[model samples]
Target chain A: MQQLNEQANIALKRTVIVAIFAAVAVVLSLVESLIPLNMGVPGAKLGLANIMVLTCLYFLRARDALMMVLLKTLLTAFIFGTFSSFLFSIMGALFSFVAMWFLLWVGRDKLSFIGISIVGGIAHNIGQLTAACIYFNTSKIFYYLPMLLIMGVLTGIAVGIAVRYLVPSLSKLSLFENFLG
Target chain B: MKRGDILLIGLVVVIALAFIIPRWFDRDSSEKNHNELRTAKITVDGKLFKEVELTQEEQTVEVENEHGLNILKIHDYGIEMIDADCPDKVCLSFGFVDRTGGTIICLPHKLMVEIQGPAEEDGIDATVK
Candidate 1:
C-alpha cells in the first residue's frame, strides 16, 4: 500500500511537471514567434520551441515527453485560435516526438547533434507536409517534398547543435535528475 | 576540415545537390505553366470555399473570414502570403506557389491557398481544407 501510494504520488508529480513544461513550451512558442528568423519562406521557422521540448525530455519520461507535446499543441491552438489547423500541428508534434524519442533511444549516452537534429528536422517536415497533403487532399506533397526534405536537414542540423549545447547544463539540474532516474 | 569532415561535407553537398538540382531544372517549366490566368482555389478548415482565376501580375488580395486576415500576393506566375496576422508566418514566408503544387496557410486565419492547373490531374486534394 505504501509503494502504491508512492507510485501514485510520483505519477501526480510527473503530471504537474509536464504541465509546467507545457506552459514553458507555450511561453517559448510565443517568445520564439517574436524573434523572426527571416529565413525567406512563408512557414520557415527556426523551430525555437524545440529547445523546451528537448529540455523537457531531459527532465521527464518518454510518456511525459509525449504528453507535453500534445498539451503544447492543444494549448497553442486554443491560445492562437488555430484550432482548425490542429490536425497539422498534432501530426507534426507526433512526428517530432517519434523522431526525438528514437534519437534518445539510439544515443542513450553519446547523443549527437547531427543525428537527432537531422531526424527531428526530417520528421518535422514530414509531419507538416503530411498534414498539408491531408488538408489539401492531394498527393501533391511530392511538389513540396523536395524543398521540405532539404529544409528538414538544414533545420535539423541547427536544432541539433542547439540541443548539444543544452544537454550538459540540463543534465546538471536537480529537477532533471528526478527525470533521469 | 580533415578527410572525414571533408567527406561529410561532400556527402551533405551531394544530398543537397540531389534535391536542389532537380528543383532548379523544373523551375522553368513550372513557371511557364503558371503564366496564364488559371482558376485557383482557397479552402478554410477542410472546406472548399472559393475559386478565383489568377493573373500573371502582382495583386494584393484580402480574404476576411472569422479566422483572420489572409493577405495574398500574386507576382509573375506565383502566388503566396505576403502577410498574415498568424503568429507563425510559415504561410507568409512560404513565398510562392507554382503550377505543380504549393500552399500558403494561415492557421490562425483558418485560411489556405492552393493552386492547381486545369490540365494538372491529381494536384487537387479530393478533401478540401
Candidate 2:
C-alpha cells in the first residue's frame, strides 16, 4: 500500500513538471514572435522557445520534451499565429526533435549541448523550407535556404548558451533530483 | 570549444559562403542586364492570371483569390508585391525583382510573379522547342 502511494506521488510530480515546462515554452514562443527580427527575410525568427525544448531534452525524458513541443506549438499558434503558421511550426518542431534526439543518442560523449542545438536549428529550418517548397510546388524557394541557415546558426548558438547556463541551476533543484531518482 | 563545436561552426560557414558566392555573381550579371526585364507574369494556381509590361508607368495590380488579396506594384525598374494579406507575407518581403528571371512567390495564396526578359529571346526559345 505504501509503495502504491509513493508511485502515485511520483507520477503527479512528473505531470506537474511537464505542465510547467509546457507553460514556459508557450510563453517563450509568444515573446519571441513579438519581436520584429525579420531581417528583410520572410519566416525568419530567433526561435527563443527552443531554449525550453533543449532544457527539457537534457533534464527530462524524450517523451516529455516532445509533449512540451506539441503543447507549445499548438498554444502559440492559437494565440499568435494562423493555421498555416501552425503547420510550419509543427513540422519544424518534429524535425528539430528528431535531429536533437539522434545526435544526443549517437554522440553522447562526443557532442555538447551547443552542437546538438545547432543541429536542431538546422533541422528546423530544413523542415519549414521543405513544407514551403511543397506548398508552392516550386524549388525556387531554395533561394532562401542559405540566409535561413545563417540565421539558424546564430540563433542556435544563443539558445545553446542559454541552455548551458540554465541546466546547472535546473539540475540543482530538489524537485528535479527527486524526479530523476 | 570542443571538436564538435568547431566542426559545426566550420560547416555552417562553408555552406553560407558556398550559397552566397554564386548569388553574388548572379547579382552582378543581372544588374548589367537590368533593362532586359520587360514583362512580369502573374500566375495563380498554375494558371496565368495577368502580365504587366515593365515600363515607366507606376501602377498597382490588385489580385484577389480564395486565400486573400495581394497588391503588386509595377514600376519602371521592375515589379514587386507591395502588400499581401497572406499570413507569411513572404511575397511582400521579396521587395522588387528588377532583373529578368527573378520571382516573388506567396505560397499561401499560390501566387507567383515572375519577371521575363525581352520578347525576341523568349520567342526564339519557344520556337526551338
Candidate 3:
C-alpha cells in the first residue's frame, strides 16, 4: 500500500513538472514572436522557445518533451498565428524534437548540448521549408535554404547555451531531481 | 571538440558550399551581361499567370488564390510585393527585386514572381538554374 502511494506521488510530480515546462514553452514562443528578429528570411524567428524545449528534453522523458512541443505549437498558433502558421510550427517542432531526441540517445557521450541543438535547429528549418515547397508547388524555394541554415546555426547556439545554464539549476531543485530521476 | 562536433562542423561546411558555389557561378555569368533586358514572370500554382517587362511602365498585378490574396507592384526596373493577406507577410518583406535573377515567393498562395533575363539558348530560367 505504501509503495502504491509513493508511485502515485511520483507520477503526480512528473505530471506537474511537464505541465510547468509546457506553459513555459508557450510563453517563450510568444515572447520570441513579439521580438521580430527577422534575419531577412521569411518565417525566420529567434526560436527562443527551443531553449525551453531542450531543457525539458534533458530533464524529462522524450514523451514529456514531445507533449510540451505539441502543446506549445498548438497554443501559440491559435493565439498568435493563422492556420498556415500552425502547419509550419507543427512540422518544425516535430522535426526538431525527433532530431534532438535521436542525437541525445545516440550521442549522449560524443555530443554536447550545442551540437545537438544545432542539428535540431537545422532539422526544424528543413521541415518548415519542405512544407513551404510542397504548398508552393515549386522547388525554386530552396533558394532560401542557405540563409535559413545559417540563421538556424546561430539561433541554435544561443538556445543551446541557455539550456546548458538552465538545466544545471533546475536539476538542483529536489522536486525536479526526484521527478527527473 | 569531440568527434561528433567535428562531423557536424564538416556537414555544415559542405552544405554551405553546395549552396554558395552555384550562386557564385550564376553571379559571374549574369554580371558579364548586365545590360540584358529583364522580364518579370508571375506563376501561380506552377502555371504561368502573367509576364511583364520590367522596363515597361509601373503596374499593379493582383493575384487571388484559394489560400489568400497578394498584390504585386511593378516598377520600371524592379518589382515589389506591396500587399498580401498571408499571415507572415514574407512576400511583402522581400522588398524589391531589380536584379536579373531575383524572386519573391508567397508560399501560402503558391505564388512566385521571378525576374529573369532574356530567354537563353538553353531554355532554362535563371531562377531554376
- Top candidate by TM-score: 2
- Report the C-alpha lDDT of model 3 over B1-68, residue by residue, as the tens digit: 46786678678867977887788777666655545567889998778999987754688889887878
Interface CA root-mean-square deviation for model 2: 2.5
Q: What lDDT is obtained when candidate 2 is compared to the true structure?
A: 0.80
Q: Chain B of model 2: TM-score?
A: 0.75
lDDT of 2 by residue, A1-181 (tens): 9999988987777777778888998888767756756576666677788888888887767887888889888888888677876787799899999999888778857777788888899899889878767765666667777878887888888888888898888889877886442
**CAPRI quality band, candidate 2:** acceptable
Please give the TM-score for the first chain of candidate 2.
0.92
- How do the residues A1-181 of candidate 3 rate in per-residue lDDT, one tens digit apiece? 9999988987888788778887888888777756765577766677888888888888778998898889888888877777776897799889999999999989989988888888888889888878877876656667777877777777877887888898888988887866454
Q: What is the lDDT of candidate 3?
A: 0.80
Q: Which 10 residues in a row give candidate 3 chain B its minimum summed lDDT?
A: B120-129
Candidate 3: deviation at residue A70, Å?
A: 1.2
Please rank every candidate by DockQ, starting with the best: 2, 3, 1
Q: State the lDDT at A139 in candidate 3.
A: 65
When just chain B is superposed on the true chain B, each candidate scores a TM-score of 0.70, 0.75, 0.67
Model 2 alpha-carbon drift over 4 Å, by segment: A179-181, B45-48, B55-57, B86-90, B99-103, B107-110, B115-129
In model 2, how large is the Cα lDDT of residue B61? 93
TM-score of each: 0.76, 0.86, 0.85
lDDT of each: 0.69, 0.80, 0.80
